[model samples]
Target chain A: MEFLNQNSLYIVLIITVICWFGIFGYLLSLDKKIKKLEEKINKE
Target chain B: MVFKIILGIGLTLVIIAGIALPMVSNPSSFFELPVVPGLEDKARIIFFHVPTAWVCVIAFITSLIYGIQYLRTKEILYDIKSVTAAGLGFLFCILATVTGAIWSKFTWGAFWNWDPRQTSIFVLLLIYGAYFALRSSIEVEEKRASLSAVYSIIAGLTVPFFIFIIPRIVSSLHPDPIINPQGKIHMNPTMLVIFLSSLTGFTAVYYWMFNLRVRFSKLLYQQQMKEQE
Candidate 1:
């Protein structure tokens, strides 16, 4: 516990959060583009 | 929502079953550490890097499969699926590269060493990237699909050589001979669990993303057609 606290726990946490977020954002945006296309297809 | 909940439960079970078991054992737990020689510790990344890389391989092969399917049937659906596979494959390739880079950086010092493994994966990325570029370069539908199909097929042959063969040839500073030549990777029960669980989790993510991408790409193509009309 002491070692975990004195060390870079926060740094690791931040990096992980950022990495997952980047992945989430990327996939979400791609899904949005697909949704937009679906609407266009429906209109046609 | 229901399926997501089921997936969540399944993933939770996998983590608990595989990761938690190995971590709790003392003698076997150290198997997780980097002190082991022959880079056994780095083999931990096998769960992430190898699976993701293989998933990327699957993605590309999928693209090639559909590309050929398009060639035979000339169905627009097959073409859309092919491009979707390429896009998702490219994403996994990026993930594999990033994970491998970080693993190499920690084990071998520099973040981006020009080692045989690193160089080959980078080249693979370039080849796949060009597949997209070639598709875009041609405006006509059939022409674009056929051209990209040829490229996808050629590019895929390099994947096996890059991911497997070349890394073994030179005296690599990287870990060696665990995954290959069966009976080499003798993992303790605990480490095996975490390793296997991670592989399963990553594989699940790969399939979900692949499905989503194919659905989305179909929409994109239809949108393009709608606009043209």
Candidate 2:
């Protein structure tokens, strides 16, 4: 119980990091797609 | 491109400041900051919950502005921006609601309480849903853009009422985290710093996503024009 109490915020921190990176990763992939589309349009 | 790189660096700094610094804060009571009753450690959710809710409103307001621009100029680009902003607003609205519900579950002992805050956000989701439905139901480009712009404008009017007015005027278990009755934030300095950093970081995230959607949609519109020519 003591361990759980102390580590609760740590767990929250880990989860927050995961959520941040997850969203950032999605945005990165979308950026790649947008770049590809930009390239395609330029070629045309 | 530089904007994206800058935003990424800023967000990394935000995560470090928010999580790392807070964790290292004197566990007993960081800088004499009173531990919120019943919230304890779970209170950290404030960083996530508030920012998501704030960005949701920002996106809706952006949609409203672009919607008005579309009506004035009849530019398809403005209409595209308006819809993209609304789409992103809806996404963030759902995120805020879900995160708030989870926080409520841990703090309030129920996943939902039908409290004024929760109810207002529910109404907001419904309004956004209707806007999307209104957009899709029309097949004609001019009709769709004009009609949805009108719908977005009308819907935007209710956003302030639901998000700001309703929650405050009615009684609820949800504490006013941002401001107090005295109109001042009652927060520790370190906590406030972290919260503000997270707020800026999340706002940047919203802009990054919103910019990507607008650019992508613009590309699609140009492609269609080319094909037609």
Candidate 3:
């Protein structure tokens, strides 16, 4: 807590990193869903 | 599979290094970034912001290529690819503009001052906005594809002029571009490495997104055809 208070930019960086990971994870899931849909359509 | 893993890990490392690296006036070691006189810690925006613009340019050029290919081959797949690329370009263009605006607020003391660089990108946004508008207004598939292809080619021709030439012609508050008139990078070696790495990582991310979009678009087109049949 003390270190974070002293170095506030790191806090922003941490938040940004978390947000990026969240977005990346969302994209990964979306890609998997698209792939599954493609397979289903092909099978039909 | 390997490329995806590499891209994920590589971008994570880039973000860490770009944000966490210490900036010093005199960078005596490899890890320390030389402080750009006016930018200071704010200089870090280069890693993320510039890449968005670079990706935007790359996406636009790709759209242009596929547009030309569509015109030559008259294939629906090429049209799909062309439009997908343009959509991605527009998205990144917006990212670039927003990121630039935020950075400008800190550096230039305003969100927008109508700097030459800002003006040019605004014009580009309008041009591509019209491209999408033209695309959606046409109901006929073939007509929409060919007309948009021609429009994309013309819009792409203007890209180089707007992104590269106009900014240089008029003096502005914006910093000299990475590839300046002197044709030399002014960054310290450590900064350059991270900057180049960030560029590569962002480009890979763009490619991944482009692939996913094109695949999804193709699937949608197939479904539409089946429904019509």
Candidate 4:
């Protein structure tokens, strides 16, 4: 707990990076899903 | 596919650099000007907070344009686009509000201030939320599309008033950074670079999210059409 308080800035930096990377990851996965959907729809 | 991948990689890099640069850079006391007095280093929140609010307004404007297009053409696709844009707009609006609330809690020593800017943004959130509720409550597809498009148009028109005009018209603790006549940013050069980079990075993120949502909806529509066949 004391470690968290003293290093709040680094903690924030880590959290921010994680959150942003998570968003990008979600978008990347969604892009893949859309590609597959497009392929499926095109086949019909 | 390649374009989007490249864009994704580029945007991720820019956003990471934006966030990292601000955190790592030294705070300057040049000209005895501080971005936000009393907040000091914590004023770095400005990079994230301001850009999210800007993106929110951009999303609302995009929604408004699509709403108008839907009304003009009465095309279902236009309506779909409008609703999708509104959905993203509302999410970013809520983001802005939440980030602002957190900043306020730390800076002002309270979470909810009822300041003019705070009140206006809260109202904007409620308005956007109501737009979603209104859409979900309607059962008929055509009616939902048409009515919600009209509602979105009206609500979207009011966003500028809520976000920009009203807050400035009344006193508020939130800094009126853009409205300065000179249009000059007052900050250390490094801070300015990070601020501008964050703004660009956020805009990129907004478009990327918007495109993802729109394409996902298009896929769903395709699925729906096949089901009706």
RMSD of each: 4.3, 2.9, 2.0, 3.6
Q: What TM-score, to 2 decimals, does candidate 1 have?
A: 0.77
Off by over 4 Å in 1: A1-44, B1-3, B9-35, B38-43, B180-185
Model 3 lDDT on a 0 to 1 scale: 0.89
Off by over 4 Å in 2: A1-6, B20-34, B182-185
Tens digits of lDDT, candidate 1, A1-44 = 78777644344445544665576557567767767867776776
Off by over 4 Å in 3: A1-5, B181-185
| Reference-based lDDT, residue B23, model 4 | 31
What is the per-residue lDDT of model 4 for residues B1-229, given as tens digits with 9 covering 90 to 100?
6755665566555445444443323355321224345565566677788888999999899999999999899888888888878888888888888998988888788988898988998899899899999999999988998899999999999999998899888867776555653333456665566577677777877887888788778878878887999
Model 4 interface Cα RMSD in Å: 2.6
TM-score-superior candidate, 1 or 4? 4
> Which 10-residue span in candidate 1 chain B carries the lowest summed lDDT?
B17-26
Q: State which docking tier applies to candidate 2.
A: medium
Residues A1-44, model 3: lDDT tens digits: 89878887888788878978987887789889998998898898
Model 3 docking tier (incorrect/acceptable/medium/high): medium
Candidate lDDT (C-alpha), each: 0.70, 0.83, 0.89, 0.78
lDDT for each residue of candidate 1 in B1-229, tens digit (9 for 90 to 100): 4554454555555433432222222364444422234454455455557777878888888888888898889798988788888888899899889988998887788889898888888998999999888988999888888888778778877778887888778655555435554434455655566566656666676777887867866666666776899
Model 4 ranges off by over 4 Å: A1-3, B1-36, B180-185
lDDT of 3 at B223: 87
Ranking 2 against 4 by DockQ, winner: 2
> How would you encode candidate 2's per-residue C-alpha lDDT over B76-135 as one tens digit per residue?
999999999999999999999998999898878998989999999999999999999888
Tens-place lDDT per residue, model 3, B1-229, is 6787787788888888889989887889999887777778888888899899999999999999999999999999999999999999999999999999999999999999999999999999999999999999999999999999999999999999998899989987777647564532268888788889889988988898999999999999998998999
